[model samples]
Target chain A: MLEIQNVSVRYGRHQALFDIAAQVERGKITVLLGTNGAGKSTFLKALGGLVPTGPGASIKLGGVEIAAIPAHRRVEAGLALVPEGRGIFGKLSVAENLHLGGFAHRARTDEKERLERVLDLFPRLRERMPQIARTMSGGEQQMVAMGRAMMSHPDFLLLDEPSLGLSPLLSKDMFKSLRRIASEADVGILLVEQNAKLSLEIADYGYLLENGHIVGQGPAEELRSSPAVLRAYLGEEVVPA
Target chain B: MTILVTGILLGGTYALIALGLTLQYGVARIMNLSNGETLVAACFSAWLLFTTTGINPLWGLLIIAPLGFVANGAIYLGLLRPLVRRATSQGMLEVDSILATFGLLFLFEGLMHLGFGGAYFNYQFLAVPFKFLGGSYALNRITAFGAAAAIALALYLFLYKTRMGTAVRAVAVDPEAARLVAIDVGLIAAFAFGLGGAITACGGVLLSTFYTFNASMGAVFTMKALIIVIMGGVGDVRGAVIAALILGVMETLVASLIDPGLTLAATYGLFVLILLFRPQGLFGGAAG
Candidate 1:
């Protein structure tokens, strides 16, 4: 289990996240839905130790406090984040990118087996292994980003807008892979998304954030019918029965 | 024919000098104006080794090159790293780094002046001249060129075939992304600066075997290296070598065909033209 409590983020004078708390259970997907400037990204960054949190903030992975852990050390503690825009090394080949993703686990004997597993999860990546990452399409780059994180074999994965710029079909494919990984691989996924409908469809639980505050939280099925979620995110498009 | 051959030989030296600057500025974006000082320091160290211990200056490379590498690494860690950390903007970092290197240049110049004094010295080495393809050439010059080529080839293989080399390239391409992938970016930058120092200092050790020098010669070599790096399109390694060769031929031709006084002037004139037309250089990006 990964737990965040009373987490707050302030950038100079502006408070990006205020007293935010969330929990992610193993083998489950937890979706965070928010609009632009709603502090969804900030919360994810705080979780990954990519951003500093204010007083009273606490983060733990399986009872271990990781709030003070540095971003580089977070991976070794079984935490990984696929940051917004898919921060891929564009000049490197896909293989090199994956190789770097396994940096923390390099000493492990199963590193090779883990790499083969990532390749199996995204077979298209195997085909483009030798090509430079910059030459790949948007969907392909997203795969490399996810595939790279998977190479680390983290117990918890924090994804920030993974579907941005990807097509609807590609987004569905990505969600399917995420679902399989969460269930079969026993990995916890903390996902932040702008596409609330599609993300909620696969998420076991949902949190609705607005202006750096978590206004609502419940099971995904209840949140789908909640008036506040529909008014802020879903708009006129109703959740399919 | 002699002029052409001499130019080619000179070009190899220029390539060696520019390779260091290319690594410093082109890849790391640090304007290391003190590069010439590092080279001169290596030459002085070799000279000191020769004069004190009677070791051949050619063999002095084993000591001087590593000294240069360590000294340059100190410069990066002590001088440049703090500036990088304190800088709030990229432009500010570049400017501050350049200023810091200028300070280093003067410091090295002053130290050299104090240690070696105002006198010039010629390196003691075999000067047997050999005829090749109807042109007479000094054996030392040929040996220097061969050494430079071998070092360049080794550098190429390191950057292409090794794992740490891949990490260096990855950092060069995108530092922030490299950090996300767990690459210690600061360590990479330091390694690059140290390696740059080592390679250029090795060039200096070779140079000491064939050339006469005083403490102040570093400034002239520094400018030449900067020109070659700019002409070669900055971070492009292969382009730097080609541009160095071209500049060598141009300098030799102008010196012999026109007037020796106009050699650097002609080279700078061409550089201005290249900057005016293709600012990113021959191999730089569309607008680099």
Candidate 2:
């Protein structure tokens, strides 16, 4: 399990996140939903240790406090983040990118098996391994990002806007893969997303953030029919059938 | 044809020198002004090894190359790291690094003067001249060119075929992205600085046998490297080699056909022309 407590982020003077707390269970998908300026991205960065939090903030992964860990060490701590914009090394070949994904545990003997599992999960990457990442299509690049993270064999994966810039069909496929990865791979997934309808369909739990505050939280099915969720997300005309 | 051949041979050393500068600029956005000092220091070390112990100058590579590598890493860790950490923008980093290295350039010159005195020293080793393809060439030039070509090939293989090499390229392409993938970006940059230093030292070792050098000669080599790097585009390794060849051939032609005194003037004139028309350089990549 991954737990974030009292997390607040400040960029110089302006605060981005204010004492936000969240958690994701092992082998389950937790979807974070919010409109623009809701601090979803900042919260994700705090978990990844890319952004610093306030004095009282703490992050625990598998019973270990990881708040003080540097961003590069977070991967070795069984926490990997697929940051916003995919964060792929655009100039490197896909194979090289995947090779670097295993860098955290490069000394481990099971590295070859880990890579084989990642390739099996995203077979598309296996075919495009030799091509430079920048030249790939947006959907393919997204796969590369996810595949790269999986190459690290993380216990918990944090994804920020994974469905961004993908077509509806591609987004659905991506969400399906995320679902499969969370269940079959036994990895906790904390996904920050904008596609509420599709995200809730696969999420086991849901948190609604507003103005950097968690305004609502519940099971996926309960949140799907909530009046506030309906009004803000699914709208009055459509109510998840 | 002879001028072209001579120029091409000399160009190999230029390319090796500029390649290090280009990597430092391209990956870290640092304008390492003391690059030439590193070459000169390596040459001096080689000179000391040969003159004191009566050993072959070529044998100095076993000693000078590793020292140069460590020296570059020390320069990065001691002088440049803090500046890069405090930098808020790439432009600010470039300015700060250039100014810092300018100070370093003088520091190295002073050290060289204190260590070796201010006299011109030429390595008398490899004095044999050889005949090749209707042209008589000195053995030193051929060896220097061969060593440079081999270094270039080795660098290419390292960047393309090795994991650590890919990590370096990944950081060069996008540092933040490299960090997310679990690459220790700081460590990679330092390693690159060390590798760059080692390569330039190899060029210096080759150069000592062919040319006369003193403590102050570092600044001239530094200027030539800057000209080649600017002509090739900032951080473009392959482009630096091509630009080095162009400069070498052009300088040789000017020296042989016109006047040896006009070589520097012609080189700078060409540099001014390139800046006026194509500031991004002939290869056109990020000048940063």
Candidate 3:
């Protein structure tokens, strides 16, 4: 489980995020919904220790404070961020990319077994294990990114916009797989998504962010049917009774 | 025809030097203007060992290479790395890298001048020209080409096949992503700098034997190295070999068709043309 308390971020004169607080349940998919420039990615980055936070910002991973930890050290302590843009090395093969994920830990004997688990999650990867990752399609690359993150076997997986460029069907399949992964692996997930409806459908708990503030938080179904949420995202102009 | 064979042979030597530059540029993300300087430095060290101990140039490499690795790593950390980290402009990074290394080159040349007294020097070769392809062509190398080839192949294999090699390549692609997986990108950079230095051993030895070399010799030879690296395609080692061979053959042909004085000019011209057109180098599809 992860708890972020009053996190804030500033880039010189620009305040990117202001007072973002969210709780993520272990073994559950927690989705954060926000418009563009709403600082969803920045919030996730703050948790991963990639973004510097203000004095009041506090990130707790499994109840341990990671305020002082560096990004890489945070990863070493089981916080893995599969950043946006798939970040998978196109020049490297799928196997090498996944293998390198387990490089830092001492108990990295899980390569063969974890690889098998990854193949089960996305079997297409096993067939193309030796092929160059850049040669794979976007959806497949996303799967590779997720699989690569999974190789770390992190207790907390922070997926930043995993469904950004996928087709609608592919996005559906991705969310379905993400839900399954959280259930099967029994790991905590903090997902930032642009697709509000699809995200709330799969998420156990959801937070709606607008203008860098936590504008909404509750059970997924509650927020999904809210009229204001509908008007903001759906732009339907009128909410159904 | 003899000029052709010689040109190709020189190209082979040029390729080894370019291969070092490729790794520095393609993987390490450092412009590494000091590469040729370091190779020249290696040549001087080998020359010193040969002059003092009367060691065979080939055998002296085993000692000289490790020294080059340490020296290069030190230069990268002490000189270039800090400049790169502090630089805000791309032009500043490239300019500072180029000027600083060239300055280092002059400093190194000054030291070599003081040490060797700038007198023309050659590390006597055990070199014997052997015929290949039924004596139609001469490899003109006594283990130097073989050694260079072996080192290049070893580097290619280590980078593509090994775990650590992939990590280095990953760092080249996205340092941030590499760090996320917990690779100490800084350590990877140091290792890359070391590997780049280690691989330059044969080029220095061959330069010492096959031609007249002084501390300043690296200046001209390094240009040939740059041409080869560019022709081969920036980061691709395989491209480096092909470009080297082509430039070698080209230089040889130029000498035969025009004049020996024009060989260096021909190389420089070809480099300009390639920069204007391809800009990527020969095997350039291998970005990162």
Best by lDDT: 2
**Model 2 reproduced share of reference interface contacts:** 0.72
In model 2, pairs of residues that clash are none
Candidate topping TM-score:
2
TM-score of each: 0.93, 0.95, 0.92
How well is each residue in A72-157 modelled by candidate 1, as lDDT tens digits? 67777888889887888887899988887876643255878888888888899999999999899999999899888887778998
Candidate 2 residues A111-158, lDDT tens each? 788788778878899999999998999999998999888888889999
Candidate DockQ values, in order, are 0.56, 0.74, 0.74
List chain B TM-scores, each candidate: 0.95, 0.95, 0.90
Q: Provide the DockQ value for model 1.
A: 0.56
Candidate 2 at residue B116, lDDT?
80
Superposition error at B134 for model 2 (Å)? 1.5
Off by over 4 Å in 3: A225-228, A234-239, B1-5, B89-91, B129-140, B285-288
lDDT of 2 by residue, B1-288 (tens): 889989999999889888887777776667889999999998888888888897776678778889988999898988899999999898899899989999999999999999888999987877788888899888889888888898888988898788888888888888887777777888888888888888888878878978889998888888888889888887677888999999999999999999999999998898899889878989875453
Docking class of 1: medium
lDDT of 1 by residue, B166-220 (tens): 7777777777667666667788888888888887898787787778878988887
Give residue A221's lDDT in candidate 1 (0 to 100).
93
Q: Candidate 1: list runs displaced more than 4 Å.
A: A105-108, A239-241, B56-58
